[model samples]
Target: MSFRARTTAVLAAVTALALGGAFAAVLVAFNGLQQRQLDASLLAVARTEAVEVHQHALRFSDRPGPAANDIGPLTKFGIIYEDSGTVIAATYPFERTPPHLADIRHPNAQPFNFLFEREHMRGVFMPIPQHANTFLFLATSREDFEGDKEYLFRAMLAAVVVAVGWASLIAYWMSGRLTRDHRNIAAVARGVARGDLTARTDVSSPDPEIVQLGSDMNDMVERLAELVSSQQRFIAHAAHELRSPLTALYGELQQALRKERDAAAYRQAIQQALEATRRLKLLANDLLTLARTKQDAGESPEAITLERMVEDARKLVADLATSREVALDIRLPKATVSHRHGDVTRLFRNLLENAIMHSPSGGVVRVESEHHGSMLHTWIIDQGPGIDEEDQERIFEPFFRAPNAAKTRDGSGLGLGIAREIARGYGGDVQLDTSSRAPGARFLVVLPAS
Candidate 1:
């Protein structure tokens, strides 16, 4: 069943059962109470008859006469018996049984109640106080009691039916209202799946958990939209950047093969073509590294020593440093960080490469590490002219080159961007430290220590 229907049915069933139980109890209690009150009235009537019988006996010279004169018999049968177990008078022409007389004469006999074994009859025996061995026996038909009980049963059943019907209606209404927000969320998700990124659930509910859930779902959709837009822009920029080198190589090859030339001329053309191809290869490798950095977000962390990582990165850029006549000053301590080894290695290598490329001849590129709380901080400082104020913030953006540094450097601008992306993927980050006390650019990388 639908949720609404099931909810309503469950509520109705519970209500019906509860009400039915209560009604049954009430009916039983009422029947008992009514029967007790009827017995009381019967006993009272019997007592009044015995008193009148005593008065009549006194008037008739100590011999009992008719016990009741004007009052009609309310019981089906009424009898007045003497101390010798003789029936003096009776409303109905019925003989008293032997057991009835024995019960009256019993020593411990008080007011007595019994059901006749052979017949559907119940009666009470009330003893007379001022008359010796005198007793009154009275019984009413059981049909009256049964009729009243049936009437109560029918009335209670009707009330239960009405109550359950009303309860079911209210439960259905309330359940539908409660699930309306869920329906709205589903509609929004369907719209999103159909490429409508702008669709959103604007529902507000009184339930705090539901409200929080809706908020989280909306936030997820918004993040997905942002990611999709970013991927599109990235693709466009990658194509434009990649085409530049490919076009230059294509033009050089066409010119070189247009006519016959000397061996030296052909050798120069091949060299130019090789340079273009080399640049293209570097760009392709950087793009792949960037993609991998994004894809390896949940890689398990391994124990890697920060000192060793920095040393390895320094060696990778050793050739460039030597060519620039730069000095690599490394002062690292024995600190270990918990991160994927490949990600940390790539991040550190890119940072060192950026430092080496920016440093002038005879300049010193310093690599240092420090332990700060749970984080290991590595600072790469170059003694070249520090970054200009305008390019410090945007330098870490992918494919973004500093206008001043771009003029002299022949490297792709994706090194720092890839480094930061990898650092962030491992729950750490790399940032350009603008507050460097030295006369060079300082990049700080922070990673969790094991």
Candidate 2:
């Protein structure tokens, strides 16, 4: 069966068991109480008559039951008998023959149940204190309270039926409320499977556990959507970036073959094609570096100071700086860090090349550093045009380039993105210094120092 159906069935079963036990106990107790009351009524009348018989008053009522429907201490039959069970004075006339009495071993003055004249009756047999072998058997008809017992049984059965149905309904409703969050989560998962990345399970509940479960489910979906979106966006941009150079190289070869060309013209076409091929190779390497920075194990970690890492990166980009006639001003800090060697070096080198590429041919690109608590803060400030205000926030996104920023002959827009990812991998971050006054685009690099 389904969960809700099972839950409701179980609740109903438990309710029936509980109410059955309780009502049965009540019925038993009520019967005992009625019998005890009947016995008390019979005992009082018997003792009073025994006193009368001892004094020889011997009074008897004409008739009490079927005439009065006796509900109190009124007995319909009071018989005084001799020891041999013969010649007893009865309170009322018998319509037919009276029932034969059983011989009790001892007369302890306890009440006993019997039948009299086809009706249920209770009697108490007691021997008179002074009289030898003489006894009193006081009996009362129990027919009046039979109707009460029947009524009580019918009432209890009805209550059990109502209680089980009502309790089961309430339990089913509560179970549905509890599992609503689960249903919502399932819906979101199905939507995601159908490629609806924006689907979310925004659910609430009075139960704390359910609330937490819903929150966790929403968080998981959000993370999955983000990863999927990033992958899609990355593939789209990489395709666009790769298409430009690949098309250019293909066009160069196609044009060179379309007609008979001179040797110098052919050489020029080949050189242009080779340059496009080199750009494609550089773009591929940058994409690979971007991918590797996500996993720190791609390169081994080592102990290196901030100044030493920055100087190593500067050496790799020094040839570019010389070719562009831009001066490099380096001032390094003594702060040390422990991370993957190549990832750290590439982080700084990406930033330095980005600066050098944007700076004018003769402009200065300064690599400056300082210590901020346990972090090593480095700034690569350039003299080129600063980034557009609209593009400042987006520059570090994969393959994003500012519209107004200068582009060199060989460049991929993933430099800033790769640099930021590597820094963040080592518990550091790279950000543009938007508030800087003196220069073009000023970028800040912060890393934890060991």
Candidate 3:
């Protein structure tokens, strides 16, 4: 699900939980308060009835018609009396006249309060002080108690319903605001992915986290756009550079082959054509290697022994060095240094070939390998005219030939660029070291040890 929907769902669930807990607590507290009030009212009624009975007991001998005055204004009271037995009475007479005062007498009769019927009622029984053979019973019906409780229950239920409705509305409003921000972020991300790197999310909230997220996303888009533009420019420049050499080679060959020529002229033309073909092949290979290195940089690395790779590179370039009359000096440590083999080898071959190609006749080209900590370092130093300090940094850029080297030989100048790309692919890098003690260029390759 989308982030906005998920966030809304989580918020809604939390709101429901909070509302349920609050509503239940309110209901419980309301019911408890009502019950306490009902008990207090019942106790007040019982006390009033007890006082009336006590007064009537004091006048028992003086009264003529009945033991008590016409049941007092507290007439809704249900009553029971016990002398020889039990008798029930009420202000309002019943058709059966209730049991007389002989049915409930017992040795264990005691005064107590209890609830009776659906209505909560309180009952009390006490012996008359002056009337030796009489006891008075009084009870108050809880109809008022029930009526108040019913009203309270209805009020509480209405409040809960209203509270829930309000909570839902608030939740909806908050979730809508959150969802809108989430949608804006998602839309911006989608646009960026579709190559619209200028797209950015609107930051409406003053929340720090959201504002930071928007800033970070915009920064990432800007960086991506720059990288894409740089890559396009590089590709266009590389194509132009390659086309120039190919066009020159094609024109030279066509012109050389157009007329009948002496053997020496034909031989020279063929040699020039072969040199052009070599340059083209070298350019194509460097470009392909650079592309492959970039792709492989994002892949899982494999183990390769530095010593073995250096040995292989030396063997591959041995013939070229011999043909050029350049002396090869290979020095590898006895212990095995492991790394990403393919990239390491590519870096080694490029640096070695660059040194050999640039070195003057009879010049020595040295290849050395060593290990330090978690890194493998390789150095290729040629005893040719060394690069200037200012040009060392830019030497690895594609098609960037140093002034002296360009004058000395027709070098394509992509070898160092391709070498550095491979070096970087293996979590390593290559750079020209102008501080070399010898009077030639020193290219250092540092790779992560496996």
Candidate 4:
């Protein structure tokens, strides 16, 4: 069933059950009250007639037929002698034989009581205390009581149906409001699934939780859109970067192959091709490392000393520093950290290489590390032209080469970006601290200290 219909049905059923129970209780109590009143009225009539006989205002012998004086609503069935069970005075002539005394017997008969039900009539047989030998018999039709109960039942049934119908209508309206809100949210989600990232469940309701849920869903979609856009931008930039070296390598090889040349000329052409191939290989490796660091799974972290990592990075960049005619001044502490050995090694190697490439001849590329509380802070300071403030923020973007570095340096810009990615993978970060140094760039790496 639809939500509205189900809600209406449940509400109606519950209301009906509640109303039915309450009405049934009222009917039962009212019926009992009516019966009590009937019983009291019968007793009162019996008492008054008995009192009149005792006061000499009535006589059984004089009133042997229908009563000449009214004795209230109950019809008198005449006075009887208890010992003989014979009618002495009757309000009307006996049309049918009376019940046998033994059949009317009550084991513990009270003063105003006997078993007297016949022909759809019910009454009581009462004995006069003043006249020990005499008893009164009176009865009335049960048609009036039955008729009142039937009328009450019909009225209650009508009231119940009206009440349930009204309640059902209200329930249906409320359910519609709730389901409409849900439908709006579902529509927004469907739009998002169809790649419409701008779609949102901008719903307003009295319900706080539903409103909060819609807000959270909108936030999630916005974040997902941002991530997908960033991925696309990265792919475009990577393609542009890879095409440069590939085109160079392809052109050099094509020229060498066409129109055979002297050995000296071929050797020079092969060397240039090898140089392009090496640059392409380096770019490809950096791209692969960055992609791996972005993935959700890889090698688990292990305990490795920061000092040993610095040593490894220094050795890896020794050739580059020597070629650049730069001095490496290493100052590292004996601190251990929990990190993937290969990732940390590559991260430090990239930073050292970048520093060495940027430094002028005879300039010092200083490496320093320290343990501070729960973090290991490392600094790689290069005596090169400092990064401009405008480019600091975008310095770590993949394949984003700074203007100065692009003009003077012979290296891809992915080194610093890959270094930052690897550092962040270990719950650490790498950033340029321009304010902390002058006439050079200072790159800081912070990792968890074990």
Candidate 5:
């Protein structure tokens, strides 16, 4: 599902739960209030009846020949009287009356007011106040309280149903407002995935989080556009560079075969052709390595022993060093220092070759390795003319040639660029040290130790 739809669904569910809980709470509270009101009404009826009974007893105490004549209309209450420790009057008719003096001695045993149920009647009790040995009990039927409770419950249930419907409507409307941005973001993301690089999500609100998301996506697209454009330019430049050498070699080979020439002249022409072919071959190999590195970009990375890899790489370049009469010095710890292996050999090879190619004949090219905390530091120092301090930063850029070095040496100017690329791929970096102590040039390689 789309982001907007999912967000709406989750919000709706939450709203439903909140509204359901609220409805239940309100219903329970309303029922409790109703019950309290019903109890109060019952108590009021009991109090009114008690007063009437007390007045009647005071009026009939002197002329009580038969208690039934003094009794008045009891209304909804059932009345009973105890006189001389015997049942004197009762509003309820019974074939055999209950004994009154059985448990009347304990005044605290039953309070003056209490709920009572006898046969079908159910209500509260209120003792009549009189000096004579008499008691009055007044009660009404249970149906009155029960009917009130039923009505309150029905009304509460209806209110809860109505509340749920109204709450659901409000929740859906609010959910739409909240998820509107999410919908726009999703639509823009789809467009971007479908090759619309210019597509961008709208951030109409002032919310920081939403604004940040939109800004980040736009920044990513811009970066991607720049990268694609650079790649296109690099391919065109590389193609032209490759074609020039090939064209030169082809022309030289064609001229050599056109006619017979002196041995020295023929040798010179063949040597020039061979040199052109060799440069073309080197360019092709460099391009291939770069392409392979890019292809294997996101594979699993593991700790590689830098010391061992460096030693192996030096051994590979040993023949080249001997050809130039250059000495190699390797300084590394005994403990195994490690980093990612991917493109690490390339990084070392490029730096070592660049040093060797620039060094004077018989000059010593030093290869040193050491560990500094979490980083494995290695440097290739040459005894050639060091780059100027101002030009050090631009040396690693692709095809960037330093004026001093450009005058002294013939190079494609891609070695340092390739070395830096390799270093970056392995989570490391390459830098040129322009200090005075070892002033020829120091290509420092730093890789994270495992």
Candidate 6:
């Protein structure tokens, strides 16, 4: 069955069961209360008859006349008898067996139910106060009591039917209202699946479960939209960056093919083409590195020593440092970090490459480390001209370059961003440390250490 239909059915069934149980309980309590009231009335009638009864001719009135307040035969009936089974006064006619009078002790009479002349009756055995060895038997028909009870039972049965039906109807309505929120969320999700990024759930509900779910789903869609936008921007930037080198390479080859030139001229064209190809290669590698850095490295952790990692990364950029006449100053402590060897090395290499490229000839690029609780901080300081304040903020953006970047060196501009992404993967971060007291820009990398 569909979820909404099942919800409606279950809600209706629960409401029916609850209302039915409540009505049944009420009926039982009301019946008991009504029976108690009938018994009280019967006992009250017996008490009045006792006070009016007399010994002369075994009658109720001493004046030898019909009593002023004697109950009729239909409403009440009884017989007075001696302990030896002799009759005293017959208050009502009997068409069946006389009331079985138990020799009850005075002041301790108990009431009972019995059938006489096919009529349901309530009776009591009473002992006379003044007359020794004398007693009275009393009974009353249950006509009014039965009639009221039958009426009440019929009324209660009708109430139960109406209450359960209405309760079920209300329950079905409420279930539909609740499930409507889920339906709206599903609709929004379907729209999102079809690439409609602006779709959102418009759910408003009092239920806490629905409130939290709708809030979370909307938040998820919002985050998804942001990610999609970021990915599109990333793709656009990557294509733009790739096109420059590709166009240069294509133009160099086309120029070389257009004319019959000397061997030297052809070699120069080939060299220019190779340089463009080299740039394109570097861009491809940097793009791949950035992509991989954001992914989970599904490998077991290795204990990488800080000093060794720094030297390994330095070796990758050793040729560039040598060509620029830059000296490396390493002062790393014996700290070990729990990370994949390749990931940390690549991260360090990217940062080192960025620093080495920007350093002045014969300048020193210092690599240092410090410990703070469980975290290790590594700083790479260079003796290069400090970045422009505006450029400093955006230097890590992919394919971005400083205004004078081409004068000093050629770069992909993804090095710092990739470095930051790698550090973030291992519960760490890399940032430009503007607060450092160093002359050149200082970059700080913070990572957890074992």
- Which prediction has the highest lDDT against the true structure? 2
Between candidates 3 and 6, name the one with more favorable TM-score: 6
Q: How do all models score by TM-score?
A: 0.62, 0.80, 0.54, 0.70, 0.50, 0.62
Screening candidate 5 with a backbone cut-off below 3 angstroms (N, C-alpha, C), the clashing residue pairs are: none
Of candidates 4 and 1, the better by lDDT:
4
Question: Which regions in candidate 3 have their CA more than 4 angstroms from the true location?
Answer: 1-188, 196-230, 249-275, 291-346, 356-364, 369-376, 383-394, 402-412, 421-429, 434-440, 447-450
* Local distance difference test scores for all models: 0.76, 0.80, 0.67, 0.77, 0.65, 0.77
Q: Candidate 4 on 29-72: residue-level lDDT in tens?
A: 98777667666665565566666666663444332222212233
Model 2 TM-score is 0.80
Ten residues in sequence with the least summed lDDT for candidate 3: 60-69
Prediction 4 TM-score vs. true: 0.70
The digit string of per-residue lDDT tens for model 5 on 267-333 reads 9999999999998888887777666654555436665576677777787778888988888777766
CA lDDT for candidate 3: 0.67
Using lDDT as the yardstick, the better of models 2 and 6 is: 2
Q: What residue runs in model 6 are displaced by over 4 Å at the alpha carbon?
A: 1-8, 18-158, 172-188, 200-215, 294-304, 325-327, 338-342, 360-363, 383-397, 400-409, 437-439
Prediction 2 global C-alpha lDDT: 0.80
How many residue pairs collide in each prediction?
0, 0, 5, 1, 0, 0
lDDT of candidate 2 over 58-98, digit per residue (tens): 44444332222344445467666677766456666442454
| Candidate 1 lDDT over residue span 1-450, tens digit each | 887788899999999999999999999999888666656665565556556666666211222222221233334556667767777666532444534566534333233444454444445576666777677665555545557779999999999999999999899999899988988888889999998989888778998888888898899899999888777867877887888888989988999999999999999989988998999999899988888887855458788788777777777888988988889999989998887776787788888788888888888889888988988888999987788888777787677777768765767668888998888877789998987577889999988788
Best by TM-score: 2
For candidate 4, give the lDDT of residue 204.
Answer: 89
Tens digit of lDDT per residue, candidate 3, span 1-450? Answer: 755456556665676567667766876787667555444444454445545655654222221111111232223444445465645334423214543444323232242344443445544455554456666554445445456557766776676666656666666677778667666787899998788878977787667888788778888888988788768867886888788778878877898879999988988887887877887887787777777877745335555566788888888889988989999888877545445566666678778888888899999988887887878777888988888878876777777778888865555567787788777765788887656477888888887766
Off by over 4 Å in 5: 1-204, 260-266, 294-312, 315-329, 337-345, 358-364, 382-398, 407-413, 421-427, 432-441, 448-450
